[model samples]
Target chain A: MNELSTLANRLAEKGKESGNGFPFEVNPIPGEVEVLQIVIEDREELPIFISVSEEQILCMSYLFKQDEIKSGKENEINKAMLIANISMPLSAFSLIDDQYVIYGSLSVNSSLDDITHEIEILSDNILESIEAMREYLN
Target chain B: MSLITKILTALRGGAREVGESIVDKNSIRIFEQEIKDAQGQIDKAKRDLTEVMAKEMQAARKVENIQADIIKHEDYVGKALADNNETLALEIAEKIGVLQAEADIQQKAQASFENHTNRLKGMIKKTTKALADMERQFIMVKTTDSVQKATAAITDNYASGSSKLLTAKESLDRIKEKQADLEDRLSAGEILQDEFDGTDDLDEKMKAAGIIEGDSKAQDILAKLKAKQG
Candidate 1:
């Protein structure tokens, strides 16, 4: 779809802009979707990633492994996760098979500004959740 | 029947009997060779399947690419016709037709590859599953044979006076007793330890300071002893 490619090209341009504080690189995965790896410079972990499809833009990033947490800290961390989930606007915190990851999506109909806003805040959701659980996370 | 024809039929029957005997003798070897040949064919089919899958992917991409080009070109054609550029519009329409035909050919190729790959996949799956079943059955038989031998060996060991089964339980009990003894020593041995604690001894300090005296309980007064002597 032209809309999809136009969106990809726009993202590619955004990825090149200096001092945008949202540095990203385009990774072409053939026949499926276009993936953009966005850097969250302040947080030292895996890069935040976004995927483009014909219908929507998907964003996600991994926070930590679930198994590394001890059972004693589960109750405290779970309480914080619940609160973060309720307070965040578009992103939702989800546990994915021994790893904690946050993810969100926006419709392609949204303007580029709206898409960028969702992506930047999707990463913020992960950072804030991690910072809140600093007592157990760090 | 005539005598010569009957003789010929008898000779033919004898030859058939000899051939049948030879075939019976080598049936197992012949069957094994056939199985090996079938396996080679299956391996070839699997290899060809990967090639077909690759072609399918390329063909599918080719179709999508041309389809996108056609859409773009058609939009241009519409614009040209709106601008009254008859020559450009006709040229663009011709190009669009070419792209459409090419896309159709690629779609056919994609379909052909899909069918070929699916057939090969089914064949390979069937052959692989049969081979796996055969291997499983062989392993089951071999396991049964080994298990019977092991059972016999165990029976013989128990029947003879040489078996260590009786002593194993006694050794376990001995180990438990030793463990219990070690645990008791661990608990009570703390009090019997002769090493002095690192802290200063209050009683020894008091005696050295003359607040208490050697060979005299605190109740025995030094003043009474002095009075008696005087």
Candidate 2:
């Protein structure tokens, strides 16, 4: 198996055995690249997708769709995202295929604890980001 | 064209029939190809380095052999001189001159090999760093591509689709509702606690009706005593 597939399996196991208060629900997305859909309990609305590449492990959560932005608010929302990107801890705002996503990148050699911590922060950031962007969202 | 330029061009010209996917496929292929090419270059450079290193070792060995021969010949010249054999000593000294010249040539060759090795080492180092940078950037691009594809596989429209992922609007609505409900529940708890405290209510009613004097201020009481005495 590839490094990503192995990491996916380890993350799933960690999600099950972790007693660190952050419970995760991991589901593998079948595709060319090993992608895992992870949902943190209580923050079920936002699901984070994790994929490991040659040098990095990326964790991303969909923030909103471009069409979901309030009409005529794209410029303002885009600016807000750009500004917030600086202060957002460990995550950045990106537009991918008309979807706005918040993603964080970690080294492939990051420990499981580091990955889990990143997930927890990412989950919190997703909710907080949505809340912050609520005024501009439809 | 550059990858960014190609992607931008595709985006601008209208991707009529899943053109975005086609662009993605092409770009991913390009990245893979580029990465492979870099790897191949690194491999070839390492091979070249090895060859250079091997030559350096050979030159070093040759220089060492020549130096050893020169030292042995010098000893022979010394023995001839000690025996008062001037002709023999002169002949041995001449042989030493030839060996020294050979040693000097080999030493120059060894120095040239050393310079080549250093250059190759520097080149390899630079190439390796560049390769690492390219790989890191590829990771970012590849991960983003995979994420976009995975999301697309589930549903084109996340809000109306059956996917578990919720749009930020819906999530924010739910969060607001939950917050409002929490506020309501907390206020209700306070009201219920007040209603359950029967004696507190009785005390308030008594104070209002003057059936029980409300806790009098010390200043008020003192003033009342002074007025009565006066």
Candidate 3:
């Protein structure tokens, strides 16, 4: 538990350095497992919730603004829809042992393509770093 | 030269004879002795007045001395009272009163220095015994210790109990953080909807199963599931 907290603190520091507002909070409920909630800037009031189990990190659900959906172009909204659809599956992949996920949604005004591309690249780098750590540990 | 004139002449002759007898030597001697006796009586009265005057002067001096002593003692009593030594003040005051009473008694007694001195000594002895008793009581009270252990014990208990509560609260804070994390996950949709949906169903199921006592247990099971996954 202490190790997990230290890792979360380091991730928060990195997020702060990248000019992203660190809006993550760790909460634990007795008889329940610990969860990490991250709210991204310019996103709707609904936050992304991640549940950390002994074995996996689970993506429970998401909430979105109806106005944000209606105001954007069909193509833009489609891209956002695709991202939302892939959110759970991607989170599941990142939940596997030694995998770190850096996930946040962009505002409607922002291009999803750019955000998705950045996330993919960042994920690759994070995966590579994790692999390196695994090799070093072994 | 009538008969009445002759009677008057005879009376005058008798008065003249008696006067002649008084003027004789023996009569003169008796007069001198009576004059000496009067002189002795006057001398004795003068001596008695002088002795009485001397005694009055001595009594006045004694009264003045007693007044001075009383004044001095009163000043001491005043100072003791100011210092909050009421027992000592009272002792001094009582001594002064006794001395004053003795002085009054001496004034009424026969004018004898020895008698006055003896009375004064007796008064001094009585006052000294009274003052000693007061001193003994004061000493006893000053030395005895009052119990303050009960007060200290209560204060110690409170301090220890407060410390225990503080430690428990600190530990409780850790569990509180875990509860907050689960709430956040539930809000963020990180957990499957079915899990929480199942929580509501469990509540109903517990009520139906005649397991009212197990309701909390069931809730605990749900919370544990949420917390474990989180």
Candidate 4:
């Protein structure tokens, strides 16, 4: 019924047309924005979460769990994250509790192409960081 | 040869050695020429790669076109045989046979060109990678050689003039002596900082921590009110 719902529907339609085969579902959240979850391929059960608002659209993928992040390797993890952030196209790294997430956002004025590109970039950055994190972490 | 001529030759040799140490022109020239040669090679390789790729593309297109022509002719041969013109059909069949032979030859040529192009691509990639590595090494060595030559010139000049330059140890000793004197002067300056003037240390510390004498507009307003009342 709102602008974000319209946008979300269009985004899902575009995904269908694009034939990327990412299983996507949209769920409404109370008083803020609807969430769109995409099952990221090759990431083993960790899904990319999407939230859309009037100001910006955000995509986040929970990359590593607390136990998956090796103990006493915060320094190496931070350094690798910093470099990956620098090299990533449209995605940035963020921390939530003990979870490592690749977060990407764009202004609401962005076209469908831009949103697709940002999501693609975020997914690629997440996949690439997994290898480096393995070496850096225990 | 006369003794004077021999002496002159020795002096020229010594002068050349000095020039070599100062400029090292010969080595620099050699390096420049080598880099130029490498650049020329890469350029030629690039040009050849383009030509080879163009040729491969042409051959591939030729094969595709011939394939289409062969299919069309086979259909025509069928139609001609159905139309009951046996002689014309035989003639068409012969032409088709000739076309198939030409097509087979072109297909072979296409395969050959593809292999040749792939080999050339691999070779160019290797040569380019080697040249890149060589360039990096050359830059490092050239920079190091320049630094070494400059240092040598300075040390040589110092050797002919000062006792400190007699050996590296003496030069280091001289440097240390100067450093010590500079540090002594600095320490004298530092000694003044150690002397304390008597003051209310607690007051200053409290002020620094913003726990004493808050600057507020409330105080100014209160003063203004009292003055107005008076």
**Which candidate ranks first by lDDT, i.e. highest?**
2
Candidate 1 vs candidate 4: which has greater TM-score?
4
Interface RMSD of 2: 3.3
- Which of the predicted structures, 1 or 2, would earn the higher DockQ when compared with the native? 2
Tell me, what's the RMSD of every candidate? 29.3, 10.1, 51.7, 26.7
lDDT of 1 by residue, A19-112 (tens): 8877665443322233455554333233455655434566666566565455688878877787778788899876533446677877757887
Distance (Å) between predicted and true CA of B163, model 2? 8.7
In model 4, the Cα lDDT at residue A52 comes to: 56
What is the DockQ score of candidate 1, to 2 decimals?
Answer: 0.01
Q: Which stretches of candidate 1 lie over 4 Å from their true place?
A: A1-6, A19-21, A29-34, A40-44, A53-55, B1-230
- Relative to the real complex, the DockQ score for model 3 comes to 0.00
Tens-digit lDDT track of model 2 for A1-138: 277667777888888876767777887766555577897765566778887766677888888888889999999999998999989899999876677889998988999889988998988888888889989987
The TM-score values for the models, in the order shown, are 0.34, 0.65, 0.25, 0.40
Could you tell me how far off, in angstroms, the CA of residue B200 lies in candidate 3 after the best superposition? 99
Q: TM-score of model 4's chain A, to 2 decimals?
A: 0.80
Query: Ten consecutive residues with minimal summed lDDT in candidate 4 chain B?
Result: B163-172
Best by TM-score: 2
What TM-score number comes out for model 4?
0.40
- RMSD (Cα, Å) of model 3: 51.7
lDDT of 4 by residue, A66-132 (tens): 4555677777788878877877778888754344667887787888888777766776666566655
Native-vs-model 4 lDDT?
A: 0.62
Candidate 4: CAPRI quality band: incorrect
